[model samples]
Target: MLPSLLLLFLSIPLTTVTAASAAPRCTTSTPIKTYQKCMNLPTQGASLAWTYHPHNATLDLAFSGTFISPSGWVAWGLNPDSPAMTGTRALVAFSDPSSGGLLLLPFILDPGVKLQRSPLVSRPLDLPLLSSSAMLRSDSSVRDGAGLHIFATLRLSPNRTRINHVWNHGLYVQGYSPTIHPTSPSDLASRATIDVLSKATEMGPAVPSWFRTAHGVLNAASWGFLLPVGVTVARYLRQCTSVRPTWFYGHAAVQIVGFLLGTVGFSMGIIMGRASPGVTYTLHRGLGVAAFVTGGLQAAALLFRPKTTNRYRKYWKSYHHFVGYGCVVLGVVNVFQGFEVMGLGGSYWKLGYCLALSTLIGVCVALEANAWVVFCRRAEEEKVRREGRVEEHQVVKASIGI
Candidate 1:
């Protein structure tokens, strides 16, 4: 099991690298028109293609994104000051309310949008946006039947090389107003810096990739694997006469290590939540909190454990067992939730976790069956010994009476 876990951990970096390398590159071969340079955006499986004319200081660009729903909206824009949603001159595309046809309109995202003070109504941009158009075309590459493309021409200030770009998608619009998008980590971190002259691009500020990976690994190992293993050890090992008090020590040590690791992972999670202010995983967070609290209580119970001769010892034992098992269940469930939160629901990381957990369960089942067999055999032997003693007593009594 340890070797399997190590292999899984080592493969994490490789998987991340492979996924990044596999991102589709942008190309100047759109069905509408051709472009000079192109690059893939960092999030949302989106891409940008553009032709920059330095002499005229004009840019012709196409932004492509998969539609999340039939009534959803897609947007791409330039943030003149910073790579953030606020203060962006954006082009939003959605189905027109009047004709049910594709509509592309410009809107300036100010601080009000962030505050959600009112609905997002389209208005003229303050920048020199020459012309804008949009189209919905059938795309086999996308999960949805169609893809959204926004084409536009803009005149930029002379000598301007780099620009901050922000893009996002939403699931609904109300009476010609595009509603706020989902507050997922991907949605919140959907901005980048692009250089038109050099055709260079860089992802905007977000949580460090390494930190997220470390958080997942630590939690999965501690709450997901080690805690359950410790429970199994305590359940079966203590039954053997040879391992008696040694089993208790081993169980305590394993649980302590697991709890300590889980606490660190939980702390990392809290830090991440604070870092990404708007994003929330309510269920996952709740589960983690519950598991951590239960584990902590279990640890504390050890200090106040009642002696075997005390009348309340049975109650303490019951409490310890109940809390310990509850913690294990919560931890395993939250581990799966963690995978989904990290967007690894269908990845090999999840598969590896499942395999490890399944192996542990199988081991427990085998041990339980063997224990039952051993218990029944011992009962049968004790019964036979009692019957033999009774027969010998009867024989001695008959001889004395004769």
Candidate 2:
């Protein structure tokens, strides 16, 4: 298993993209679409779109409009069903007349989550997701900071970005302008769209594109590293031994590492989605969360089991059996889904997992058959002993009566 993990690291090729130029004055992120394609010409709904290059191409952004305010703009995007839009300078709505569709402005929202914190743990962000680039909420707005610089904290949506560990090295594009626009409502003057893509240009070798690729590599590596083979090893141990100690330790360790990588990787997925909202990315986020939640349940069960109690001590077999099986099933299913999302739909990874599981199943069946044979032989021997004892007792009772 350790060898397989080590090989996994060496296997996935790493790719990075650095910026080629400097941040131009009044620049927006490239492949900047007009309001037309953002609407999806014919059957237009909420749009979410993006591209996944192998860390070679320049950063792609859709919304290109720049605000000219003296103070920095406080930009935020939320579902109206969430925080309803008010007329405050901190909030603005961009509603298109033709579509009657409202979207938030700018490139800020991340995937894997959306704007809500109710008891309902998860909900589809419902934005139209597309590959390459996506449209923003047409009804959203940005309020100027004293009408000069734009600054705001974007509450992340798991569906928007892969809420990965990339936060430590976040790619933010902050712009400070000289004048404030009189036409704007806030205290400041001029406005501009500071795309993170341009920030990549300014960084020389330190580009935002590299972060994007890093996010993908982590996602692939996490999903690939375990879950498939680990699940098989853990479950196979169950049919062989009632204690399932090997199964327990193996499953726990794999899950711990798998989830850590997944958490960081999933965060990147969310970031990708937020950078570009689309169905493929959103589905990826949803599955990632599902895996995380199930893993948590499995971990919690292991934690709460009363290993010290008398009954538990005796029934450790039962606890181990159930938990082991559950982990195997969930882990296997999630691994399959992860591979599909990671663009390895028909790749060697799929073949390897298939053969490994099939082989494990065969081994488990053989072991179970052997156990049953042993059980049957023991039952027959016990029956003979009981019959002989009954005859002896009958003879002794007759002698006593006489």
Cα lDDT listed for each candidate: 0.86, 0.40
Clashing pairs in 1: none
Task: List candidate 2 segments past 4 Å from native.
Answer: 1-15, 19-284, 312-324, 395-402
In terms of TM-score, the best-performing candidate is 1
Distance from true location, Cα of 39 in model 2, Å: 18
TM-score of each: 0.56, 0.42
* TM-score (C-alpha, index-matched) for candidate 2: 0.42
Q: Write the per-residue lDDT of candidate 2 for residues 1-402, one digit (tens) a residue.
A: 989976754544333211122222232222343211111100001111223222443222232233333222223233322211221122222332345343233332223112322211212333332222123323133222111111122333323332111000011112321111122111110111122322211111222444444665564445544654455566456555666677768766876777677678667666654443212334545656765665566566666677565576657657656654554454456567656555556878678767766776787688668768877988999999999999999999999994
For residue 378, model 2's alpha carbon misses the true position, in angstroms, by 3.2
Tens digits of lDDT, candidate 1, 1-402? 999977976787677678877877777878799999988776688889999999999999999887787777899999888777889999998878788778788889989997789988888999889998987756533234367789989999999978888899988888788889876657866777779889865552234456677899999999999999999999999999999899999998999999999999999898877655334578999999999999999999989998999999999999999999999999999999998788687889999999999999999999999999989999999999999999999999999994
Error of 2 at 96 (Å): 34
Superposition error at 75 for model 2 (Å)? 30
